[model samples]
Every structure is written in structure tokens, then in C-alpha cells.
Target: MKQMTRRKWLRGMFAGGGVTLLAACGGQPSGETTEEAPAADDTAADAPGVVEETGSAVTVTYWGSFSGDLGEAEQAMVDAFNESQDEVVLNYEFQGSYEETAQTFAAALRADTIPDVVLLSDVWWFNFYLANAITALDDLAADAGINFADYQPVLLNEGVRQDTHYWIPFARSTPLFYYNKDIWSTAGLPDRAPETWEEFMEWTPQLIDGDRLAFAHPNSASYVAWLFQGVVWQFGGQYSTPEFGMTMLNENTVRAGQFYGDTTNTMEWAMLSADLNQDFIGGSVASMMASTGGLAGIQESAQFEVGVGFLPQEANFG
Candidate 1:
């Protein structure tokens, strides 16, 4: 087995609000291999456009895909870091959406002009490892004396592949059950979110307004699979084995699919929507399962008081 490297690079970048790339380091873990060439040494010391000596501060570039208030927060962090230290200068850039950032990074990799630090999505970072587009941080972690065990086990494990850690949980999030408190009150339902699918189904009638949906199913390909995973687990089924090399097509999975179909197709309580959050905020939907990252935005946008809760589970499973 190949030894995995601790995600020290992530720790350093996150702490400093900047990142540095070490291109000469490369290693293959498990069955994967890559022949990618090293990126040119373009650190602040050698980069042409930057001043080599800014009061002896080391400049680092960070690329991210944050916008709106989130973008402002990131800029604020950069400002704080710059103000606190004279040894490091952090330059932050908003690189559009995650997909666009990935595309730009791929192009940069081919040209050997990649940014010192770039944000990669949870689903996409594994591909970067396969391509050897990034470096391991075992040595760096040891040099910095980072304690990997201090991080949350679940969140930290997401970064570990075959033992190697390639990504860290930054801006990590999960689906939340967001409900309109005013709508719930009008419906005469309980003040809290439903605890089970059956309970939610029971409350649907009261939640409905003439043409409004009680809930909206996420329709985008990106969200459907993620949300569906919760359903599959709730039904006591595994979508795939732990290794993800084989899929399971058992009765539980079938039942889970049937439940989703019933909600959207048969019962008419919920409809598939490309914009569930918008509908929920606009009063077209009484409730939705959405990213917790949007909680603040939803609170600011909604006219009614918002209530958040965990995703409802199957009664039997709960």
C-alpha cells in the first residue's frame, strides 16, 4: 500500500489565506499513475509581474469561486491576513463558478501556468489527484508540526483517498430542511419540522395553497443524486458498496425510488424543480431540502420567518 500524505497544504493555505505550489514533488498511490510535467517555478520570488521585494513579504495568489456576500467575507479574510502580517501578502481572485474554475485550472495545468492555489469542488478534486496536478503534503505537515487528528473525523476523511489526502473540507455543507414558519403556522402544523416522511406527507394537505406545492423535488443532475443518497440510506439500502466499485439494486433501493416517484408523480404534493430555493423563498413552495450554505441567503430573501431542520427520515428506520 502507498503511504498517504497529510493535507498540510490545505492547512497552510487556509490559515495564511494564500497558497504556494511545489511542482517537482510527485508520487503515485495505488493503481494510478501520471506523466504530467512539473510546473515552472513561478513563486513570488521569480514571477515577473510581481514586485520581488515588498517589504520582504512573500506574495501568494489564491483562486476561489465565491460571489456576493460570500465573496465579501473572503475578501475580508484576505484583508485581515494582510493587515496582521508583514511576512506574507495574500492576493485573492474570484474565478466564477466551480465548473469554470476547474476548466481554467485544467487549461493552466496543460500550459504549466497553474495558480499557486485554486479551489476545486468536492466531486472534481479526485480527478486532479489522478492527473498528478497537485502535490502531497506529508513532508510539509511534518515540517509545520500540524496535528491531523484535531480535525473532525468525518470532514477530514472526505479528503483522504487510498490513504493520500488531496483535498480538505473548506466551506463544507450538507442539505438542510428549510421551511416557511408562517406557512407552517397557517397550515396549523407543528412549529417544528416533520421528523419522518410519513409525518411530512400527513402535513402536505394543510401546507398546500390552491396552486402551490407543499414541497419541491430538486431537479438538477448535481442535486438529485446527492439528495437521493439520503433517501437510499433512509430506506436501509446502499447505493453502492463502500468501495463504490459495485452498485446494489435491492428492494430497499427500489422502495426509495418508488417513494420519490410517489411524491412527484402520484401524490402531486411535490414537483421536480430546477430552482427549489427560489420557489421556497417566493412562497410557491412551503418547504425544501437545500444546502445549508444558503441558509443566510434564504433568511435574507424570504418575507416569512424561516425554520431549519434535519432531513426527514423513514419512520421505520428512525
Candidate 2:
């Protein structure tokens, strides 16, 4: 597409209200396609400039997953886009977590009732693609003047399937190791992150006492499985092969599982937490593996010094 500053294109995306679907249905033949023109944002009907400048501005309905501080930030972005110009206004609606958003979207597909834009997590996008419910973004992106070259390859490439772009990266994140620096100092451990899981194990006894955890594990809904993916990779294992072959029964996978099992059920230094971030902030746990997306919020909320490090290595770093 045309060369433009990233800032301008980002403004262009939300200004149209549907970065993912606003310039949609590219490559798909016209006539009888499932895609539809974006409906206008009603909340902007009473806003100034919209009626005076353009009669009716383009409105892109968006569904997303974010609440509390994150949600407020998301709203700020939407508001900024709406106020940036009178040509378009983003109508963002919170649909709970990524999984919940996907679930509602699945239902919308069946009912033929859908939003113009959606925030799809990496894993959820593929499901919609497989169902033939989403369109390739190549043509639409071109029409929208998006510069694929500007995006990080690792971030941009994840959306490719059959040589076409079906998803785009926006809010991407990965697991980060968050530790309580006060706890670490009091335990007399080194200030830096542990070099390896073995080393962390050696230090765990020093951190834990009287039901306090050296580390805490999140529950499944908090994305325990996603967090565990890092550990699996650190142990030099994978959940599956590229072609979707199961690898959970493999030796390295088994070893990873065993190590996790031992942490909670055998070693007694870590335990599964109801809320990993809360537990860590409340001083119930010394460390945890949580999304980098949460780091800012954690830092704002925690009473103690919060330190982040690379996830301690196992057989290899994830």
C-alpha cells in the first residue's frame, strides 16, 4: 500500500472504526459475500461535529476484551479517534475476555448479526478463519493503504494463512516473570532473576515459609495453559507439531508436566493461585508468570517494589 507514518495509519484504522473489518472482504468476489458494510455508531449521534461536518460520519462497531484500567485506556483510544475527525467514530464495546469475545462472535456469525471490527487473540482468529467466517485482509489492507512492511515480521506474519492476511496484530503480549523485589531482598537472594529453573528451585526454600509461595500459578481462566506454554518451550517441548500432531505425551512434555506437578504437589514452594497478580501484590506470593500486558497495572497497584525479568531458563529459554 501507500507509504504513510504508522501514527497516521493507526488513526486511519480507528477513524474508520474497524481496523480488521472496515476495509473488509478483499480478494473475496463481489456479490453474495458474507461481509457487510459497517453500521454507524449510535453513541456518536449526539456528538458535535459529526452532524455539522459530514451529516453522518462513518461508524465502525468494535468488540473487544479489556476492563478496569485496561478498559479505560481502550476507551480513551476510541474517544481520541472519534474526536480526531468528524469523518468517522469508533464505537467500541467490551465483550469480556478474549475467549468470551470469540464465543459471542461465533454466535453472531450464525445469526448474521456482527460488528464491523473485533479484537481477536492469536488462537481465536484461526478458529474464525477455519469456519470461513472471516475474510482475507490483503485486498482490504491494500485499499486502506496499510503498510505491511511497517509491522514487525513476527507480529505481522502470525496472521498469514494460505499466503493471505486474515488477522492483524494490535494488542499482542507474552508471559513475563514478575517478582516482588522486597521479598527477594528479605530472603537474601540475588537482585537479578534466577538464571535457571534449577537455580530458582534452590532459592525457593529461602523465599517460602508458613504457606507463603516463592512462586504462584494462575488458574485456567487466568490463562494457566497459556502461561504453561512458555514453561513447555523452556523445557524444550511443544504442545503440538506444525501440522497439529499431539506432542503432550512426548518425553520433554512429560518432564515439563512433572516439574509443574512437583512445584505444587511435591516441592511445596509454589501453589496454584486464585488470582496470580492479586496474590503477588497482596504479598501472598513472591513471584509469578503473567502477561506483559498486566505489568503496568501491577506496578500501579503493588505496594512493594515490582521487578520483572526474563522467565528463568529451564533446558532453554522460551
Candidate 3:
């Protein structure tokens, strides 16, 4: 992407943090995507007899994980910024996904070649903070006269550490339910997704049968944690302590575990081993809990009618 002033970009990010999606305490995508356009183009220098101070050109390197069309779109925005003015030259580089970008960043930090700006996923915010590798941009904002309140509190909460802000929120994502509408209707059910947890359970058995599962794709610590969050919250429980130094697997977690175990083992309406994309596309599963980022890709790939709904809510208290 075009080179933007590091301080200036930080200020913009501070004010526009909501544009980026934070990691939904759950991993399912909630149909969120990057919504903000590229940062405003720098004004032309020497316009209308305004004397432009010519100075040494500076190079600002940016690293991100946006591949395919996403990468192309990102580059287009960067190129616009780069060509907007004759001041700083912004250099854009793609380093794969968040994990790959972070790995490259780690190497740069070790070699003292860290870029002028970097895009970080929400989960890594604390890691960078704890490692003391990220630069705080609070005073940078103050100098630029940007208001911080324009951003979402969640973004600020994740970005700020030790009274300073380092990374700016760039892309945000959330998790939601994806269902097969045709299958539901063919199964003699309404052409609608379930709303309450009771309704979901009441429909799963009827919607699924031999050789097909209602749900799939569990077993990862990340996804497991995501699924557990909904149930744990429904049962008034927490996964860890406030300090995040302790795990809190109370009765709620136990109950949640039993519920899931029954679904995959006893009920057989779900698979414990199938990848979500494959099973979802192959029509092997009726519903899936996935990230919002996958929607476009799935839509392009799915052969059957797809529908979306909010995750079901439990009807009864624990």
C-alpha cells in the first residue's frame, strides 16, 4: 500500500478502529469485513502558490496478509496512497495471513528491520504489548489533534496497553450460523433457520439422517473455545480468570462438554472429523458455525441454497 505517515496513519486508525473486526470471543465469522476506504489522499504540495518544503523522501514499509482478490484490493488502496503525494513513499508487501505476517514481523524485530507500519490481528495485540515490541502512538495522536472517542471501545481496549496504543484495528470478523435452506424445506420443515437453542435441537434430528450430519468441524482448541463460550455464557460461566492466568472449567464447561459430546457421539447428527468447508460444500452437513470471512468464498463454491442466522440462544436457565 502507499506510504502513509506512521503517526498520521496511527491517528486515523485510532479514530477509525471500528473498521477492523476484533476476534469474536468465538471464532465463527459474523459476516464482518473491512469497510473503510483507503485513508484520505495527501493534498498536493505547492498548490495555489503554497510553498512546499522539499525534503528527503522517506520509505515506509507495510506488511499484511491479504491474498488473491483481497490482496489486489489492498495493493490498489496502497498504490493510491503512494501516488497521492510526493512526500513519503509507502511500500506495500504481502506476507501471507496473520500468522505468516506475524512470523515475518518477529524476524524483523529480531533483525531490527521492522517496517514503519504493520497490520496485526486482534489476538496478537497483547502479545506485542507484553513483548514491548510495538510503539505507542498516543502522543502521536495528541500532536495530530485526533479525537480517540470516534473509535469503538472494544478496539481501543484491545489496542491499548500500559496507557499506550500500538497497533490500529484494521479488519474485523465475527462468527455466525450458516444453514442449508433447501435441505430444511425438503425435510418438511419451514424454510427458516432456528432462533432458540431449544428450536435448534428440535430441528437437528429431523434435518439430519443417515450419511449426513447436522454439524461438523470441532476438535480445535480455538473452535472448541468458541463453542464453549456460548454455552458457558448461557450457563453463567467463564473460561478463565480476569488475569487470564487461570482456567475456569466449572460446571458450565462440563455441561457444555457433555452436550457437545452427545451431539457427536450419541446423536450422530454431527461429525467430529470433517473439515467445515468440505462437509459444508459437499452437502454432508446441514449447518455450520463459521467465521463471516468465509461467506463470499462459500457462496461462490456452494451448490445448494445457503441461509444465515444468528446463533441459537438457550431457552432455559441453568
lDDT of 2 at 145: 68
Which pairs of residues have clashing backbones in candidate 1? none
Give the distance in Å from residue 237's predicted Cα in candidate 1 to where it truly belongs. Answer: 3.5
Better of 1 and 2 by lDDT: 2
- Candidate 2 accuracy as lDDT: 0.69
**How do the residues 1-318 of candidate 2 rate in per-residue lDDT, one tens digit apiece?**
222332344334433332352211111111221233223343321111111123455555688776777679889988876776765656788987666666787676655656766776665455565555564566556656676887778767767765877676776777778899999999999898887999999999889978788999977556677778889999999998744578999898889999999999988899898777789999998999888877888899999999998898988897
Best by TM-score: 2
| Candidate 2 stretches greater than 4 Å from native | 1-56
CA lDDT of each prediction against the hidden true structure? 0.65, 0.69, 0.59
lDDT (10s digit) by residue, model 3, range 72-150: 8889987877677665565677876665566676665555555556676654434544455554566556655656676
Greater lDDT among 1 and 3 belongs to 1
TM-score of 2: 0.80
